[model samples]
Target: MRLPVRIALLLILFFCADLCFSYVQKELRPQTALQERDIPNALHPLVKQNAELLQTAALKKGITVVITEGFRSIEEQNELYRQGRSKKGNIVTYAKGGESYHNYGLAIDFALQKKDGSLIWDMTYDGNQNGRPDWLEVVSIAKTLGFDWGGDWRNFKDYPHLQMIPG
Candidate 1:
């Protein structure tokens, strides 16, 4: 083969290899990590503002909260729905694909952030020592910010979920 042709072929192979590696790396990342990383950029404007307020209010009450998920894609929602039914994990959600508010960028899932920076979804954890669970405190603050807590749902209590419905 000509030298120029060989060089071009080598560059093409390198580009293809690089693309594949990038895709593999992304696919290997934990789903929660991806969602958390995308939260700030993926949420709707009003939802984001309210989430910020909720976080601030929770903090003032000596509770440290973290948004674990925001603006879920339909594909991600489907994957969640499949859990327990078709997947190995326990069922985490009833909503599938477009059915959830997260698909519309209006929903967020939160967790408690301990002082050591570890996250927990324990609803009974009262890290703030305020006689009330920090999770409930965050929920109260979220409600004040116009977010509806999924924990209020009768059918499925998703304690981590909150969403704002537009008027």
Candidate 2:
């Protein structure tokens, strides 16, 4: 093969490789950061306060709850909306970017944290030995704190979702 053609091919391969890496990184970032990051500063003050209270209340019941999402950016929401549609995961959300209360910092998604420190989404897991499911307990607390449970939605039940709307 000619030297110039070989050099051109190498450059093309490098460009393609870079593009692929960038795409993968972009796709993985939100999922990777889901429960790892702190609750976003963009959350409404009252919502943030209630979230903390909800956690404390759950902890008192021997259930550790972790906020998995808060104050999502439009781009992140779009990425999530792509799942099970344009992407390779189950459809986790029905709302698009601007449609979700998360876009405005009024919503959150939560999971139960086990004694082992790992998170689980199992709604029926009763790690606390409570006859009542811990997930429902948390939802009850969240509702008292003024959060609307997505699990109650008639159309789509997003069990992990909680949102506060001004009255």
Question: Could you give candidate 2's per-residue lDDT for residues 1-167 as a string of tens digits?
Answer: 99999999999999999999999997565445443434444887888899999999999999999999988887888999999999998998887877778877888899999999999999889989979899999999999899989899878999999987544
Q: Give the whole-model CA lDDT for all candidates, comma-separated.
A: 0.83, 0.87
Please give the lDDT score at residue 151 for candidate 2. 93
TM-score against native, each model: 0.73, 0.74
List residue ranges in candidate 1 displaced over 4 A: 1-41
Q: Which pairs clash in the backbone of model 1?
A: none
Consecutive 10-residue window with the lowest summed lDDT within model 1? 32-41
Q: What is the C-alpha RMSD of each candidate to the true structure, in Å?
A: 16.9, 16.9
